[model samples]
Target: MRACGLVLCVLLLGGCSTTTDPSYYWQSVSGHLRMVGAARPVDDWVADGRTSEALRAKLRQAQQLRRFAVTELGLPDNNSYTRYADLQRRAAVWNVVAAPDDELKLKQWCFLALGCVGYRGYFDEAQARAFAEQVRHAEPDVEVGVYPVPAYSTLGWTNWMGGDPLLNTFLGYPEGELARLLFHELAHQVVYVRDDTVFNESFATAVERLGGARWQATASEAARAEYARFDERRQQFRALARATRERLQTAYALATRAERLAAKQRAMADFRQRYDALKAQWNGFPGYDPWASQANNALFAAQAAYDELVPGFEALFEREGRDFTRFYDAVRALARLPKDERRAALGSR
Candidate 1:
């Protein structure tokens, strides 16, 4: 899930006369309102005779996972994931990420409550594309990428809006994936820093991976095997991206500008070639093909944020004796520190 601006900030931006246009703010409000208006409690769906058994099962599983998150993982027990929203769309929102054309550093957007975030989200895909195009035009040297997001979190601020609902966009995901998504999103409510996108996302991802592994421990053999296959592909994808990112960093650091450009081209080509090979090995699984095709600084930076520091967070979990409550308290303590001290504490800077 991508981070979003607060509704109040958006409305304030809409009111302000800034150099940047306010259309983005208005669209965000309209889009979010639509989602909030579409939600109904899971109980309502469960009691409906029109609900399909398969969907009902998935909704029930989501509810169970939500409970597990609160009880076992110490995630916030809120209205999120307790309600259902049929968005009637493939993606809840589309996010636009951008970086300098020559570097992997993600551009940040600053807002009131969220401070600075690495990506901007839009409820409309077309609006997202339009914004991305605007960014490209504004900075011709930037590398812009538009990607769809299945879900996002409001940081429990919108619990009054019935919290975050189980949207149709991601309700059909495999069991393990659904559980991981729930765990990851709920982790945001547990501990979040204002502006540290990398730290925030990586922490959530660590929780997701840890919780997913725990959930798989008691899963049926069939489910475990299925998740194993899915995780294998995910790991392969991450390895490829990481290798390319490392190469790009080295190239940028040591090579002349022209040499760096050439190296980047070769690195991307190699990345796609390796992905093709991996896809063939997966019996033609094409889950990651789109990512490879659109490999850019923006995409690379965005993906890295989720995995960076994850190992450190996992180590912290181990240090906390794998106690969920204790681990969360440790994280919160780290969050209370200044940014530099926090990074030093995690040994990540």
Candidate 2:
């Protein structure tokens, strides 16, 4: 799963007066302009003699996935992903997530257009780390984790400025994984609600999983096999993380603070032991090693936003007869409801 940050206010550069922090808004504006400035039409890249053959092939395949997203998945057919950019870096942005040491609820940052979201994203890694330090300083009991984000969505807000371009950060992903990332980002443009990160991300996650499966059904055997290996590890890791979160939540609810803290440490230790067993079963695959090492209340809370409500959205799709258009309509109806009501409707499904 790709962890996506939202740039909801990128187009509102002129509205800086609405933000409490001018420097933050300026960085968002400058960083987005720099990325959009680097992009070129995919056709140009394919025709360029200087382009590597491997890259040309990947760009062409991306265009095919983009078309499939529109014609088959009922996604927005817009300027997004029609071009490409190479950020010359590992990640497009770094996201900072924070939560109280004893709680799973993440600290929320309210933006002018995006309302309140659980994480803050920065284009520069140092800036992100500095902000994390500030968060820790402000609340001594808070746990902060900063992680790289491969891509983000502007939510169709910047279509006039060439929209969101495909970036080098994730262009080399496996075929099935590529399809899932693209589907997930495009789903944001389909239906999004203010201040509901779990609702929005889980809805997108459901789309990615559903669309990725459809894509793999017609993909080459090698691609299918590769995706199977990758997804299997991902599923196992998510299950472990989910169980750890549940156990910690139970621990946090104990009668006394000392008991809760002791229980939390025990749960985390067990989680690491279980993960070690999984790595052995996987023949020493270490893809999730970094995440496991950095496991904390903030990281667990952030991960939950992408997983918690996925089942309900998947169930909604099934109830809508698995029709793409009908499923989207049903989701949009739910999006219009108040947040509490929307959660109830999905929970019932």
Candidate 3:
């Protein structure tokens, strides 16, 4: 889930001012500030001879997509995604997510006003790993994961400072993937519930999938073909992951603890075997092997956050006649409902 920049001030300052927890506050504040400090205007990069031609082209395409997002898709025309930032790292932030070893349910981290979320993000990777280790130590039966986040949205909270910027971490994505990333992040700014991970992430994922298809339709033929190949593989991978999650869920529900553990091992082994078979279809793609090898409850829960409820949102979009404004309005209306009512309204579990 995307972290709102406004929440940072509250999380950081409120901790120091109101609560006794100052260390966590200081680290969060420092990390976020450092990231925001690194942004530079896209034009500045373009004018510099230091910029590579490929990067220049991608930036130009990003500008086009930004306009399409606002004008064509009715997304907010804000300072977000208008500028660029070079994180000079492989990832923009590292997120710590945890779940019980015996269940797929995620552990919640509650903030003062933001309610609770399933994960916490740190700009520093080491800090994220440390936090994950702490969680593991605290709960012996907890499964923890430290994963990298390429980009995140502040929900337009930093528009005054030029909103969320295009980052090097994600700018190098394939054309369709890059457009989807921007659209997905920007969708977070459109409608965000305080503590509903399923609602927020699934909505953004729907937008990315929906908007990406439209973008692809108008893209150059070469770009379309390239994305087709990438997306097909991605869908297959997601299907495999989802199937494994269901198997794990079933395994965890076993009557006996010993049986559950045995089933869990079998499911994991099958997951790896299936992934290896799928990898062959991709002509030796190793991009997802690391994830398959280290699959755990925390990782599965994280994936479900983005994947679950997506079908429901997509159905809602179709019901809205594929109109962006109508779809967003409908989603916002649902967002106002009580959590249970909201999910019920969407006809999703």
Best by TM-score: 2
In order, what lDDT does every prediction score?
A: 0.83, 0.89, 0.82
Poorest stretch of ten by lDDT in candidate 1 = 1-10
Question: Which parts of model 2 are misplaced by more than 4 Å?
Answer: 9-19
Candidate 1 stretches with Cα past 4 Å from truth are 1-19
How well is each residue in 1-349 modelled by candidate 1, as lDDT tens digits?
Answer: 2322222226523333222667777777788888888999999999999999998999998998888888878899889998998998888888889998779999988776567778888888898999899999999989998887888887787787788888998888888888888898888888879879888988999999999999898778987888888888888788888998999887777557888888888888888888889989999987776667777999999998898889999999999999999999999999999988888887787
Per-model TM against the reference: 0.95, 0.97, 0.94
Residues 283-324, model 2: lDDT tens digits:
999878877888899999999999989999999999999899
Question: Candidate 2 versus the native: TM-score?
Answer: 0.97
- Against the true structure, what is every candidate's RMSD? 2.3, 1.6, 2.5
Top of the candidates by lDDT: 2
Q: In candidate 2, where is summed lDDT lowest over 10 consecutive residues? A: 10-19
- What is the clash count of model 3? 0
Better of 2 and 3 by lDDT: 2
- Rank ordering of all candidates by lDDT, starting from the highest: 2, 1, 3
Q: What is the lDDT of residue 276 in candidate 2?
A: 98
